[model samples]
Target: MKDEKFNILLADDDPDDRMFFQDALDELSIQATLSEVTNGSDLMKFLENNLNKLPDVLFLDLNMPSKSGMECLSEIKKHEKLSQIPVLIYSTSANPEVVEILYNMGALYYIRKEGDFSCLKAVIGKALFLCRNTRLIQPERPDFLILVDDIRPKLPL
Candidate 1:
């Protein structure tokens, strides 16, 4: 299948981390338009500014200065147009509770921040794949990030 183009919104406080992920995405040859926001309030402003366009995927950092990732995810999920977009919690925190909570809140996946490109590639690959499929309704299992070979359940949209 031909790959579809997409716009990815990354909300993270750390510039270095953002660049790392961007590099990984570039290496993967994934066609995407990346937009970044440093904090939750900035993310909200970004969403407002891009009034007509909703991001295909959102990579949200759990902790931020003004508004936390949790807050941003909650706010986005509450909105009709935004709720349909996939939100992935990207963070340094490996806390299971955080993952569970976000998953239940409709996050597509909760992936921990890794120090290298290979790890980043896995996350990016999963995100790109998820974006390609329109069937997924609720957030997928956290293990989906680890189980790359399994067939994803086809959601009836």
Candidate 2:
């Protein structure tokens, strides 16, 4: 699509992280329409309600109260209508085993939340690009995770 505002959905419980995310997007000056949900349950509810008008991408936090991102990811992938929305797992943890599981479960990318705003913006930008280029279909093994220290295409099994 030419000259379109990217539709983005973010599900994170941390107020600070949510604010930082907004700030980063503003700083990047990305043309995007953003939506925020504080928990996984609400996130799923939003998706169910907006099935006909799903966001272009979802930035999911792996940690949250009630329903976890892992649970939501499973639900989303199983739902035919929601499965096409590319999901980026945004979180603070950098567990390699967890990352591998999420990647195998069908998340397009797993990104460790960056502490620096500049880095956050860069990572967000890179993620958006990937979402644009690889919606629905899972990325190859070499393009699965983005850690604070390094962005890895391959996760050790």
Q: What's the TM-score of each model vs. the native?
A: 0.85, 0.89
lDDT tens digits, residue span 136-155, model 2: 57778666876534523321
Q: After superposition, how far is residue 67 of candidate 2 from its true place, in Å?
A: 0.3
lDDT of 1 by residue, 1-157 (tens): 1377778899999999989988878877668888899999999888877768888888899899999999999999898777877787888877777777888888877777777667667666766776676455554474534332332232111
The best candidate by lDDT is 2
Per-candidate Cα lDDT values, in order, are: 0.76, 0.84
Per-candidate count of clashing residue pairs (backbone under 3 Å): 0, 1
**Candidate 2 clash pair list:** 142-153
Q: RMSD of each candidate? A: 5.2, 4.7
